[model samples]
Target: MSSPLSVILTQNKLTGENFNDWKRNLLIVLNFEKHSFVLAQPRPPTPAIDAPDRDFVALERWDNSNLSAMCYIRASMSNVLQKQHEEHQT
Candidate 1:
């Protein structure tokens, strides 16, 4: 079973509405925890005509040196995603 903190850490979706706050908070939390991570917002291949209509893709990358930490984080994220999928299906 994964811990609640791990699930909360990985479950946030970075959207334009809260981009600045999300980035700041994520950096602070990950840094304080000594977890190396990269938060990137990639641009779509085809740009949207309207600025607000543009889709932003957020990618998170982290080091896998610590096996336990890696597994814990991955499992937590997987569990949350699975729950989200099931919820959408119902």
Candidate 2:
């Protein structure tokens, strides 16, 4: 269920002792995927029906980035960690 690009990011999965390296690698991959923005920004609130177009667009972008980051994070974790974090978004 993971993307092929996960291979590039998960060369060394997030073992407990490797937080620094794992985070660095994950950020590099996330940046390459153009999803690093989600790390710096909080999730935007959902737009109202009559909200400006830009609001919808921002929410869409946030969703894409959040999903991508979540998948990558899961793909790079040990099975135990992944299960514990199944529903985490940030």
Candidate 3:
């Protein structure tokens, strides 16, 4: 018999100046992987008199039958994020 697959629960940071573009790319990645996710926005402990805080996209749930898909999603997302980081660095 084969061992059961493990579920993946992870978060992707959504930062920098191009939030909309980053989010759109991440959505595409998730859709391609057929994975459902939740968008988590950072909230301050109290009303911030200054600016807003950081945010993230969380993949907290997955289909147990296809855990391997998460691996592909993670790799693709990592690549996308790295590209975005490099672009911002320039």
Candidate 4:
């Protein structure tokens, strides 16, 4: 049997001070053949933030061969982050 491969898709956001400005960036990190790679998604670049830094991020891993793996991985990561944020609010 072959070992499973994994990939991570994440979105990182930087928000300005006074919560007045925001920008979101997407990244993908893959793990294959015992090596890792980081790629920036082909999307619009984040605009400059006007205030102090805040971060929002997510990460997900999945078996590379499965159909719809990318979608599941992304959703899992987002759900995890959402739960974390909700916990912090309490």
Candidate 5:
């Protein structure tokens, strides 16, 4: 079965023209999922080889959240918008 998030996104695909509304909806879902930190905080730089364990952990969490959030954003975007953003680094 499709996920609730997929259902919401299917109902309100991001078409660029409704960017503000789409962003609001997306933020609400991300926050509810506890993945909003990836967007709220600046990404921590790659931890050094000698970095503390906590640093490594933070980076891992940030990386996971970034990837997950990006996937959700891309999934919700209109096909044209998704293609246009396919090469974006961030």
Candidate 6:
């Protein structure tokens, strides 16, 4: 099948106003989960800007934590997901 996976890819652009409301908070949680499972594992490492230091490693670790949280949050929405597999011609 050559069909592209039609996943409900939500681009959550959370703002300070969203955080102030409870309903938006739930959406934040829901969106995080959908993003993590549907999408592939995100890259954690960043390019060296000035020099390689512990700060960079710490930043990377923080990003990894965010990624992990995203995956966990997305666990609830796995049922309605649409997965597509590309079929190649031999």
- Which number leads on lDDT? 2
The better candidate by lDDT, 1 or 3, is 1
Backbone clashes in each candidate structure, one number apiece? 0, 0, 0, 1, 0, 1
The digit string of per-residue lDDT tens for model 4 on 1-90 reads 122322222222222231222111212222343212222322223434553233111111112222132333343344545455443311
Instruction: After the best TM-score superposition of candidate 1, give how far the Cα of residue 1 lies from its true spot, in angstroms.
Output: 11
RMSD of model 5 against the true structure = 1.9
TM-score of 6: 0.31
Encode model 3's per-residue lDDT on 1-90: one tens digit a residue: 011111221243444555565456555554545443322222223434453433111212323313433343343345556565443311
Tens-digit lDDT track for model 6 on 34-66? Answer: 433223345445767885687587666656555
Q: Would you estimate the TM-scores of all the predictions?
A: 0.31, 0.85, 0.29, 0.18, 0.88, 0.31
> In terms of TM-score, which candidate is stronger, 1 or 4?
1
> Which ranges of candidate 6 are over 4 A from the true structure?
1-48, 78-90
- Select the stronger candidate by TM-score from 3 and 5: 5
lDDT of each: 0.41, 0.84, 0.38, 0.28, 0.82, 0.39
In terms of lDDT, model 2 sits at 0.84
Lowest summed lDDT window (length 10), candidate 4: 55-64
lDDT of 5 by residue, 1-90 (tens): 134665676677899899888888888778776788988798999988998999999988988888878888888999999999999766
Off by over 4 Å in 2: 1-5
Candidate 5 stretches with Cα past 4 Å from truth are: 1-3
Q: Give me candidate 1's TM-score against the actual structure.
A: 0.31
Best by TM-score: 5
Please provide, for model 2 over 1-90, each residue's C-alpha lDDT reduced to its tens digit, 9 standing for 90 to 100.
255556766687987788898998888788878898998999899989999999999999999888888888888888888888888767
Give Cα distance to truth, residue 20, candidate 3, Å.
0.3
Q: Where in model 4 is the C-alpha error above 4 Å?
A: 1-3, 7-38, 41-72, 75-90
Which of 1 and 2 is ahead in lDDT? Answer: 2
The collision pairs in model 5 are: none
Candidate 3 vs candidate 6, TM-score winner:
6
Cα lDDT tens digits, model 1, 16-84, are: 465565456455445555543332322234535553432322211232213333343344343545455
Residue 7 local lDDT, model 3: 21
